[model samples]
Target: MTAYTATVTVRLKRGVLDPEAETTKRALSRLGFELEGLRSTDRYEVDLDAESADAAAARAEEMAERLLANPTIHDYEVSVEER
Candidate 1:
């Protein structure tokens, strides 16, 4: 089996209410962050044994679509890496 590295970024889907992000943005603005279009997110990097990058990416997508993200409100992106 070939060793593969998977990286995923998870975020609230568009049109979903992000209370945490809003609260954080308010706090940041209070602190003079002067930012716009604030967004909150999570990221993960997983190492696995797979035959190819395409396979790894497919598996990662399934994992995200099934477990890592909420289809109604969350979204994710996956990428496979060498080494």
Candidate 2:
């Protein structure tokens, strides 16, 4: 098996309510940062052994779907690289 690192990024869906992001955006605006919109995301990195990069990505995707993200309200992305 090859050592790999998988990165999973989780964020709310476009129409979903994100209070944390909204609060942060308000804070930024108060600080005089101009922006049309803002969103917040959670990133998780997993180190594991897999047969190939595809396998690593697949595992990470599964992790995101199963636990790291909420399917009903969240959208997630997975990426893998050699460690």
- Among all candidates shown, the one with the greatest TM-score: 2
Alpha-carbon local distance difference test for all models: 0.88, 0.93
The lDDT, on a scale of 0 to 1, for candidate 2 is 0.93
For residue 60, what is the lDDT in candidate 1? Answer: 89
Q: Per-residue alpha-carbon lDDT of model 2 for 8-49, expressed as tens digits?
A: 999898899988888999999999999888888999999999
RMSD of 1: 1.1
Deviation in angstroms for 46 in model 1?
1.1
- Give the alpha carbon lDDT tens digit for every residue of 1-83 in model 1: 78989998999988899998899999999998888868889888889889889999999898898888888888899989977
Candidate 1 residue spans exceeding 4 A from truth: none
lDDT of 1 at 73: 81
Residue-pair clash count for candidate 2: 0
